[model samples]
Target chain A: MPLDLPNPTDLAVPGFIVLMLAEMIYGRMSGRAVYEGKDTLTSLLMGTGSVVAGLIPAGLGYGAAYYIWSEWRLFDLGHAWWVFVVAFVLDDLAYYWVHRFGHRMRWMWAAHVIHHSSQHYNLSTALRQTWTGKLTPGFIFALPLAFLGFEPAIIAFVSGINLIYQFWIHTEAIDRMPRWFEAVMNTPSHHRVHHATNPDYLDANYAGVFIIWDKMFGTFIPEDKANNPCRYGLVHDLGTFNPLRVAVHEWVGIVRDMWHAKGLKNKLMFLIGPPGWTPDGSRMTSDMIKEDWKRRQAVKEAAPANIAAE
Target chain B: MSLLQLLGSVIAVFIVAAIARWLFPVRFRLEDAHLHRELERVYPDLEPEEILIDRAGNAALLRLSGARGIVVVRRLGDKAVLRHWMPGTKVTATRTPTGLMLDTDDFTEPKIVLDLDAEGVSRTESWLALLAAPDGHAHAA
Candidate 1:
């Protein structure tokens, strides 16, 4: 079969439907609401957009890798099996960095924020992905796998497995496990922390299947139900279920802020600053913008009546 | 497969094993003995009236009904946080004379089973049930 041809994993239609059904069942069982009309439709649309965008480049990358690896047999590496293993790990390791960067960089966050836009964390939230994400800087990670002499099919399969493992962790149904399991692997608790908008938990855990990367890099934060409740969604919610708005909301916000910026430094800050970071004279972080707005309103109301009465 | 291929296959198998261990993982459950011991330590005052283990053995749902009310502690991993609470109202009150009937509808809705024992019973079961009704209160409408 031609490497570029669609495979079972590529046609994730069945998996997507199954995921929706599972989310509904699990959500109801856990006393959480299932898809509420428009949100369900919006999530489906946004997820479809993300998948379409992601597949195009991914398909091209796979075809190129397959051609090169099958033709050049670049390394004198003796075992086909060993080559596959190394390629898979290397891809995952690269994925860890890519996933980390997606959170750290504003440009990447525009695409990634779709996944976190849901206020209620459920399986549908997992499907609320961004089609524009593949256009980000780190999609280049596939090149390294290509250079490493692994067939694109193998690379794609390994990447698919990594993604599949992430699905079940999207639930609140499963809690903690054995100490050793949690200490090493990324459990539901760890992922819950990752999805939380709490300052203490924001961007703390960024592992895929193995949390060793987060632990090693010092990004891991254990779930503390007492001190840190997992509040789902971003600090400033989009407040709408429109997929177009969800996909480009941050990008639009970035452009507007950049345009209003008074200086080159502020303009750059608008682009590169953390998701909520802003350059207004008030020096308010994006996460605190709503609070600042309320505080300003309160101050306005508290001003001396005579001064305004004139 | 030649000697070189054999060596390569062995190496490949180990690498795949490591990746599998990293992803699509299997985890160890918190043993019932350990969970009982921890619950005892956390809530030394109340005795565990009943312990319900899920079929998968991944989580243990403990119900501690005392004079205070009902305390549901879900034990997952090393943590046994307060999962649900109902206070002041007798557990028997919610249960019919035959015992609390298992309503599949209850499982269908998203209800916050409060830890009433800790803070006192602030809301009634009927109130909570209404709040959790699937007519869609949780979603931002």
Candidate 2:
């Protein structure tokens, strides 16, 4: 079942390094404070771990997907031009759900937190990947693509393309694309909003290749730099550069929460609930934060009007 | 790869990470415009570029271009309080393999480990003439 196509992602490694160096040089010349020594090192280390840890699960996942395709595939969609297009589009759609749910559920977030651990958003931050994705059930989202009879190889290749496209959008170097392109594509601007911890920007813009998915799903929030400047990283920052801590902090947090939870239901919620959710109303989720912000904004807006009425 | 092989690779990665962390010796940099504003109360003329902050902006070390002393600032309340390290101040500084620790008669608590590599500590000692002399020298500030 070895799909004879070369690993596109492996070939892109040299390109990633060259682009990072170029970005670093540009950052230095521009004095943008793009890269910090410890932070960059930590990100690269995480990326290295991700690539290594990914090896075992990647093979396992491919095998599972291949098995499903061989046994249960409905249509024999041959390798035609339109088939590539269909594969690319469907793979991206699967990515959206996986990415979306990865943020929404605390269980998936335990693995996804590694990517958001870095405070600074840069090219290296793009390399900051999850080492524990194998533990999450998000890969099951792709099973539908295989069952629908798209080749696993095509799905993998298209996924690689999506990833390579996403790498460049992790930088602050590029601002916005052309109006039409920005509207349609997931450019750096839109992706910045996705990474932002700002209450207005949280849980918004979850698109891989196409911005239209977010637009259609009501998750799109345009990058508003002036009013709500994007603050990168977790709401509560991981203050240490310990690679092990960065990698496993969220997972440890989830375990700790579950241990302290009072009942079976509470423990289940701890695992499956959105982040920042607590049994008591002490902590705030993204929804709560957003609602609170809206209330405050309304109050501020009405203050002047009330004064005028007076 | 088999499960054992995968586990071995994971272990190897951790080992590599540990070695890299040891070799690099992590140091956190703290500099922001808000920090500059806080420090401005003490040194009105202090330039943000000349100041290097550490310990999550709780402590800062500054080298003024024309000034003769090393200025140390500690964040208190909402403001950063500055103290000048004069030529005659008794500053006891120690350097271990891990980091640099500086203690002075001027302050009650020791300046926490200025987490730096061996080379960075030496460079800082050279920059501050007070720490370079035999009287002020212990390891390096």
Candidate 3:
């Protein structure tokens, strides 16, 4: 029997409206304002950017899938329901990589930085997304799922579900879940670690619905209540709530650094190098500062009288 | 398109639009009424040109164009007096591949100054680099 095609757009509207309304009510109840002036605009811009980023590649994915499936009449995958499940799993698997790369890569980080720039993590934070991400990484992996006898609708629906499920995990209101559930799923606790800028928690957990990927990939670090309390946000915090700044601050910083760097090496390092890599032979890493202090101490000991006179 | 197909297409388009709107909004209205009121109080003589609220830095830069001189105030808390536009002095900074270079020839010979504070101070040769290129133009190779 043919699988009944559910409208992907229909599912998204109700889900988005419900989420927004829920965020507002919860925000009020929790004594957290839903939208801060200027922040609301920033959030909205970031949200729109993410959708635009997702849509370009997603649109192409749908077009190519439709072309191949229609040509071959490969719609009848015998086990349509199981195929949907497999598609969903594959989508989640792809998302895990996309999510991880967004954290690890410098260019990808620029787009993703907007999402984490907000110190306050709430439902609205989930909406803060990047518009230019698609141009950078490009969603090419989804093509394989389309090639493997899955309809575009199924793929789109599964992708939407994966995104929708991750929203509730953005809040601090929900603490630890049951032991068993936390063991297998990417709960809020795990996600808090992911969002934290703490030294130990950086680049730790990268999972969508399942924690298995992080566990399997050796990226999984459990919530250590004593050692690491999740301190939300990036290292060089963007202090303003302005959305446009939140979205393009890194880009501006990149251009600024690139312009000021003296050589090609410094220019490339500023744009494509790891975050906080400066041309002054100085690094922002914790270890670098410790070494600098040690060097100063050694100098002071070597010339105690000179140091005291100064 | 069949009935199901038509429904699916409409649904897909709508969902994409909603997500787009949810993610990238153009205008940002004030979320807190109190904050808005406070901003108004801080800048009672706020001219439209002086109200520089840029979203890119998450900080607003305001320049009060007064008779005496321009007063620059950063939204986060830094207030400084900008030097009046001198005939020979350059006000704009240009970026380059290398470190910043100043336009003035006086920058050819730069001096390093180290101010003493709670933290012990140390002066390096590089401190003169900024002064050497005081024109604010970045000279990139």
Candidate 4:
């Protein structure tokens, strides 16, 4: 039987709209959950572009996925309840690494950075996705599942479901879920750290559905609003609200850096290195920023003691 | 996605944006306490000794107590962009009829136009003098 599955994200569209409006209304009344008109518009338009981008027939997305399943699957693991359970969990693990790479590696960050370009964290911001995500080949992470015999349709369906689960976690409306739920699942608080530009929060929390993956992989950092209130958006925030510029800004950065870079090795490093990598170390990468943060923290801690000593 | 869904996404995009504009309509105005909190992450625990806010309250210049150069800040749509002036940094300033025209080599934030009155202009020139060395280079070497 030919595999046919309705995209879960498509079905979730109406719910997405309803939830976004609810959040907006709550923001209005409570004076929290703020959203700027232009930021929200840019986010929504980016979401729309992503949906359109996926429509363009690409061998990389479902095409190559289905091919791997048909020709080279190690086992014909027939559709079972257990198969879907496995696919969902496994796909999320792949998502974790893909997301991690999206931050650490500039080539992938070029596409993934669009989603984080917004300064506001709201449901609409969840829709702020990458127009070129498909081109970056994150799906390669899912290829192992196809080879292990899960159907591409099944993977796509579960992937959509995983995405839908993530949409609710994008808002600042919710502080924390129940302790048990927070322990196992990705929540609003955890996702906030992922979106934050705080030095300590950089490159943390790359979970999809289950927060366990981040914990297992040692990438988890619990949200601490007291010490580090989440500052949304990139480390170097974009100056323009234009959606086109927001989408392709990192790619443009890469092109310019590579063009001026002296050696072929240095130019190659520009593509694979961290987001702010520079030959002369003019720009600070996440690690450098974190080191500086630690140094500053030590200084502050020592100041009180030194005063007492004095 | 269906044609109607496509249309819905488009309409809802604008509608949500419109609702956001209606709900929380406050444009961020730069303030000392607010800038202090925002720049804490960038400058650590250091505090600004002198500060100048533009007439429009969208940009600011600050001179730190022990630091040599002024920090330049310009408000984007929803956030403030901070740049530390250094001796070798590419930057220039020109006086305009209404205020000051500032240019920098930063790719994302290349140009900023600050509208100021006479007193504001005088303070700005002082800040510029503090930021620039005697040889016309930034003082924060």
DockQ of each: 0.01, 0.04, 0.05, 0.57
How far in Å is the alpha carbon of A226 misplaced in model 3? 5.3
Clashing pairs in 4: none
Model 3 fnat value: 0.03
Quote the chain B TM-score of every prediction: 0.37, 0.53, 0.21, 0.73
DockQ class, candidate 3: incorrect
Candidate 4's displacement at residue A63, Å, is: 3.2
**Which candidate's TM-score is highest?**
4
At residue A91, give the lDDT of candidate 1: 77
Please provide, for model 4 over A1-310, each residue's C-alpha lDDT reduced to its tens digit, 9 standing for 90 to 100: 6478899998999899999999999988886688888888889999998998878876667778888899999999988999999999999988899999998999999999999988889999999999988768687888899999999899988999999999999999899899999999999999999999888899999999999999999999999998779988888777777788888888888999999999998899999998889999998899999998889889989999999999
lDDT of 4 at B46: 60
Residue pairs in collision within model 2: none
Count of backbone clashes, every candidate in sequence: 10, 0, 30, 0
Taken over the whole model, the C-alpha lDDT of each candidate is 0.59, 0.74, 0.57, 0.86
Tens-place lDDT digits, model 3, residues A65-149: 6666556544456445788788888888888887887766666677778888765566666777786665455356566666667
The fraction of reference interface contacts (C-alpha pairs within 8 A across chains A and B) present in each candidate is 0.00, 0.01, 0.03, 0.64
Best by lDDT: 4
